[model samples]
Target: MDARLMDATFSRNQPSDARRLYDDRAIRYDNSWHPRFARHMVELARIHSGERVLDLACGTGLVTYPAANAVGPTGSVVAVDISTGMLAQAKAKQADHKHENVQLLQHSVTDLQSLLQLQGETFDVITCVSALVLLERPYEAVKQWATFLTRGGRMIVDVTHPESQISLITFERVGRKLGRPVPFYRVPFQSPDDARRLLEDGAGLRNVVVHSVSQMDIEGRDDLQAYLSDIQHPRIEQAFTIGDADRLFDKHITDWAAQSLANDDIKQKARAVFREEWVKLADASGQIREVDEVFVAIGWKQ
Candidate 1:
């Protein structure tokens, strides 16, 4: 197929930039620290042999493949993700590991009927890692997920701390202050209590366990410079995130410009404002502080 035609077909199939962006960066993510995070999430979920597992937004099979191994041959893992590109990477890994118990499907969480058909069928464990905030309706999604769990079965999900992605959090604050809020594709939980409530009250899951692990570092000059470059990337809309923000920022001026959210002139102005604000916030506490906080929660259906 012609490149242009292929690109058009892809666009026709996956119209949302949110999906396309992950598809575009699947390779890079597979090579990043996310795999470690997935492994850790799987461990925390404590998936057992002979148990059925459903991994949501499986993403490059990070959580999916590991959970597959945990479940072993007697068990099965059905990994679902919205991005075919991401699933493709997971499928490729599937070949090497050849976990015959693993099944990969491409479907959005909102499409319940086409997802794992629940004709009295339920999983022993369900895990969603590093992908809940990306959902269209997080609370509703969790509520639905709970129904898929067998009695006494558990669901594991992770949430980012408000300050986990400080760069983006800071950028959003700057944008809001500038009266130019660009929806940056995240819904963060303000605290551990918020996460616990979401599982207990929102999802109606019992025995909710919220474990948060954190790390902090003083931001050096090099680190701040790198962050600025990320915020300034032209195609940031396509590639903004928190991990490499070590340098990941998406002050996506171009996309916003095309959509008439802001033009080049305003973007330039916003850039200066963001930098100034960032510097102040960074220095207000002496040295800039970089923080990472991730919360892993487990809840039982019964």
Candidate 2:
């Protein structure tokens, strides 16, 4: 861990805004991404019939509903999250699916102990999707979940690749071209190794398994360039602000559609600069039209 890394507690203590941010975006969350991360969650959990499942930070029920289907009518699912609006969406999704065995709990991952204790039950499998970046204490949060896990139970968490989640200011631009554009990434850790160590070893899981897969390819679309531009706009700030975020986001798309320029030329020059240094990044990212996804990380708690 870097000595300069921000304290893990910062995310947990001041999560209200962040919670609402996801809540507000819940409706469009699934549509924005190119890949189906829920499939990765199922693969990591290896969900079985008749087993209880807990989806921590179950935003808008993406993984929750699939888990319910995996377990079927005999099994039950407890979906937990910090956002009430998000929970409401999840509840609505469950109703839409007519899943009688699924339960939605409004709670943060940090409060898993109390939530589980109140239910008087432990889950056979726990899974999370994309909410890892919003957590304040990733290590403590995982440890708490592990403590509550059944003897053979395991947890599967999906988060944005840390390497992809770098500061917006760090990218290098080519002359008259948008330098190599970087993917938008969330905080907590910058590398999978760091995530594994913090969530598994530091958290005291017996045997931790880590797998990484890509989620989206930003190349080939001028719209994507606009998408990235809108995210950083002063009035928009994709993941941060509330009002007009979508409007600003739309501006990126709308403007890109109107502009007649080549992004491939800029990208190619940037690729030349970092090709050897960022071979893995090059392989992971491709055109959204040609590629299905960017990357997904699956961690198992032993």
Best by lDDT, which number? 1
Q: Candidate 2's residue-wise lDDT over 149-176, tens digit each?
A: 7767777765544334221111221211
Runs with alpha carbons beyond 4 Å of true place in candidate 1: 1-15, 116-120, 173-188, 214-266, 272-288
Weakest lDDT window of 10 consecutive positions for candidate 2: 253-262
Clash count, candidate 2: 12
lDDT of 1 by residue, 1-302 (tens): 22222223333222253366577677777665577667767777888888999888888988887787888899999888888788888888888885699878877765545554544668999888877765546788888888888999999887766555556655655555665533343445767777888799878999998775432322452222222212111111122222333232343433321122234545556566656655654443345445456667899997
Candidate 2's C-alpha runs over 4 A off are: 1-12, 116-119, 165-188, 217-302
lDDT score, candidate 1: 0.65
